[model samples]
Target: MNAGPSTAAGSAELRGEPPLVVDLDGTLCYSDTLWEALLLFLKHHFWQAWRLPLWLLLGKAGFKAALAGRIALDPGALPYDQTLQRELEHQRAQGRRLVLATGADQRWAERLAAHLGPFEQVLASAGGVNLTSRAKADALVRLYGAHGYDYIGNSRADLAVWQSSRHAYSVTRKPFRLADGRHTEHIGSVRPQPLAALWRAMRPRQWLKNLLVFVPMLAGHALNAGALAQSLLAFAAFSLCASSAYLLNDALDAHDDRRHPDKRRRPLAAGTLPLPLALAASPLLALGAFTLCALFDPLLLAVVGIYLAATLAYSLRLKRMLMIDIVTLALLYTVRILGGCAATLIAPSFWLLAFSFFVFLSLALLKRYSELFNLHSRGQDKSSGRGYTVADKAPISIMGINSAFLSVLIFMLYFNSQTVLTMYRHPYFLLGIVPLLVFWLGRLWTLAFSGQVNEDPVLYVSRDKVSLTVLALCFGLALAAT
Candidate 1:
């Protein structure tokens, strides 16, 4: 029973008359994905996933609707379900009005209604301002005023009203021939994950950070015997530690991860690898990493502890914080340098500590800027943490400039260092800074503006042919300086 537009394009035809009430969750949103997550949450943390449908049919849409309300936006809803336009139009032409009636928040439900476009009346979950279940019925009856409706809804939550409606029409893409004679129309195909999703999330780009392990080992070049062997061990151990951290982060971010498009497909998020097995394997993997460190100085254990704590805190609550979170990462990077020192017994020079802190923090800020710009440009900035709005220029302009300056100072400081200054006969690392900056800050800002740098700049830079060449030049110059 279609009526007037919800409040947008075709809604004006309602003439304050009886309109259709279509629910949001199953009818408009690809709610099954959300349902699956809730199902999994219930299974892993509460009960089993298979019993969700049974619970839904048991007049439990109110509870289910509340749960679904937690995650308001789906990652793939750039263009939500639009196939109902024709039928809605047909019904509107037949002198019926259209409205949205749901057990979801009126505020959030408004967005779904807007996407459907041009509805006259909207009846939604009034849990906040009004009652949701029976009150929803009261609102609907008041709006239609005995004219009644061909109400479209998914669950038994609609049972009370379905009996009151003139005709019951169920929207389900999955074929169903009702015993009462009406058939569920085939809407279209349900979308599946594309192959590219896996590649994006693995973020092969950020793997560049793993190379930092080699930095300590490379610094070990100052040591004479057994240095290479020790360095290789450190690299292996560090890689394992990083991988372990990644696994742990993904596990903690299960819900938020599912809300992210690229992140949603992570093996753990997609339900490809069950959490129990992953959780069981994590400590074993971490223990193996610790074993690698134990092969070196036992002091390396402290380094591993700090790494674990910092990353765990980041995954837990630190990530939600804004600039402080960025600085926390800056300090965490210092911890890595300290860890390297612990592993190799190399006392970190004051300059190295200061420079690394600034440079790494600069990189972290750029990473934030990149993510911020991407979200803003792509109209996905609701996930922002820096308290910046999509339209606000302060985060980008102020933070971006600050990070670039810090990085440039780091560049200058490295050149000004006696070690680098004395080693480079040609004074080339200074010149190399030009392209390095272009590649470092320039390419990153470019990718960010284009919304292509959601991952890490280092990883993306490594893949860029020009950036790779510049990095090679920097490395060669640094080696030459050595």
Candidate 2:
């Protein structure tokens, strides 16, 4: 976002004119400090969220102060608007006074001012009174008199303060109506369209993982139209649940994710998606998923509940454990098959369970291995939010390859079983599947080791022409055996 031409009175302020007061949240910074405080509170002091209403009953200022005291907000890591920062610097160079006025707690406001280094004064929430709207307007009016200072802000709450200012500049493209005939210019187009950012934050691409919900129906050859419809419903529920988990993870991991080159562009980390919106959407999505699951089948709903619990646990803690992390990921994948079984009333098969564990474990290990490889290439020794290190690269590779081979062994054992003979008229034809599995697994690991498999292994296979062809051949072989 860039600044537009300032009004004559606003531009005159560049030559030692009246003070310029800038709102902090959504004006000076792309993200809101209040939302940052809320996220930090939920991430570290989650138990305190229940007490927020009680504190707010006392007042907004007191609530903000209480929350801000507990959160360790890093001012330097905040998503400040680059254009606003540059404009502030330019105004500073001209010896113009800059004041930061915000409804955010004074503690956070001070830290931000200290970090940014241009603000001469910070007027913010304090003493149980929230400094916003009318309060802010009154304070500025008392300090600088009506129309004595130029104000810059974004939200509608800023309208009250802008009414008292000499001129207004904003971070929004929407024209601010000035009843008092004061000039208003849009300084930059900073915030993303809320609906679009929310959609992106849901991460539609990752929903591909939920297709695992159809595994059991396909494997059992019971995929008639009715079963297909049920599986589709199950798929939708899992997708919603998965998106909820992802939003929770992204919000909690925002600080760490910002340090990563690729992850920094994620909506939450980039400050394009509002943190409050993410927080609101997560539980709503989870509820919607559970509701849909309940309407389908109680057993399926229970399985989905377990999946959500396990996923949340993984995001909160298990993901940091060494082998346990990968094991949990494997279980999460296997649960999808369980969900499918419940949806279709298919009895659980040991072969399918074992195969899923081994395969997904290998893929999970590949994910970590790729992360370590990237860190190694960057001269970093540790993987963020993970127990793995650059030195553990060889072990991860060995384990991933071995796990993949173990899955192949499971497939071979399944083919040799009496169950295979009972199910297939010509079970011998299934031997063709073994070589395909071997080739796919071998090629997958080779690419991962060579840093070619940089995305989720499932997503990789979905996009890879070679993997797709091998998969088709394997399916054909299985059909011939049956």
Candidate 3:
């Protein structure tokens, strides 16, 4: 259905009106099909990602052609600009010939044209030459001659075509009227303010997880200016790394996230944040993290690198692997504590590391349990975008509770260890931590079982008043023992 500009003019003449040509990416739709295909490529055929730059060397049109050939996007699922659609339908009803003219590969443009149905003709890139800017203008002029067609487009690249058109309909964030007597109608509503959406995407509140990097200083009783500075640097490095991981996760999950009620509103899934920006920011943030860690200690940098690798694995594949996903999540938390140890040059104690692993394992299971609960409540049989089934809920609850109890046992054993006796003035004061932990764990599990927990367990604890009070009491007791 990709008809040339001449076909558009012929069709326009038969309809007795100028054809309406609409830009696809960023104009008729809020998203770019190229970026969409790229993400889909990474998600399903990730191994083929290294081939991307090679394809781009041929040119943007060739790159897009190669990518579009590999992935078939469901046009009905795309986030189209509803206002534009309504306006196009009105014009279509008035006997205007509608044409979909875009720089996107002809395959996707054709698919979308058929899916959306307003476009009688699709004018798009066939191969080497991208149909944009001057090329687009020439094609329009060849078909309809000077000022014989109307162009609706977004971005500066569209200005060339707009200038050649009888009427210029712009989709822009800023407002202005055409002064050269070319008629224009501004389309699209005021875009949603992005600052709040960006903040949510960064998930600043989740930075609390990086506080684990301070645990080594606290455990080593080295709370001096030097140790505090080291710990702060570690916190910054880990926070940056964590944010980078979150950005990558959101980008990769954008496809599935759109299907979730709450997650659909995420910056990437909702198209509030552009995909190219997210892709660029991820690596820059990771580099900043590595730089901070390198300045602190090479060993710290190494640990941060491993943490990033593990997280990337989790985001890419491990998250789909059933019970292994929870175990990997636990390991990720324990690695943060290890990062703290490296930052402060403290030797990790087996008792503390073991305790961290088991506790975090329980919390990880709680996260999955919460997700399952959400699905079960909605009468769904299985967790969406996950491997877990609703039938496994009881077993997960049992395993989570067992892991929690095991962490408490490890803490009790640590109190009886020679290390505790050597490091503490009053070792028995540490015993109080066990009961406090028991109560907190029990409360958390009880809440999760009743389907009251929707957030990650770590995040839940950070915001809960009771959890905060228990944490303070546990810290006070540990300080008393020290």
Number of clashing pairs per prediction, in order: 19, 0, 0
- Native-to-model Cα distance after best TM-score fit, residue 229 in candidate 3, in Å: 0.5
Q: Candidate 1 regions off by >4 Å? A: 1-206, 217-225, 384-388, 391-393, 419-431
Estimate the lDDT of model 2. 0.86
Higher-lDDT candidate among 1 and 3?
A: 3
Per-residue lDDT tens digits of candidate 2, residues 1-482?
Answer: 13542335364546557898999887887788877887777766665678888878877788898888788689977777887788778788767898999998989899889999999999999998799999999999999999899899887888899888887777887768877766467785457797798888899998888888898888888859988988898899899999999999998888778888888888988888888889899999999999998776888899999999998888877887888998998899999889888888888789989998999999989988888888888899997778889999899889999999999999999999988888789899889989999999999989987888874788888899999999899888888877
What are the per-residue Cα lDDT tens digits for candidate 1 across 1-482? 23223433353444444556666655554343334445335423443446556546635444455555544544333223445556676556656677777666565566666766657777765444332445666676766654276566555555555555545555543434444555433332233343343333334445456556556545434544564455456556656666666766665565566666666667656644444545555676678889877766578776877787787777656777757777887787677667667666766766667766766776677677666665666677566324445554456446665766666776676666776555456565456665676556666666666667655666666677876777677777656645
List the candidate numbers ranked by TM-score, top first. Answer: 2, 3, 1
Cα lDDT, model 1, residue 436: 70
C-alpha TM-score for every candidate? 0.57, 0.93, 0.89
The digit string of per-residue lDDT tens for model 3 on 328-390 reads 999999999999898889899999899999999999999999888888888888765688998
Clashing pairs in 2: none
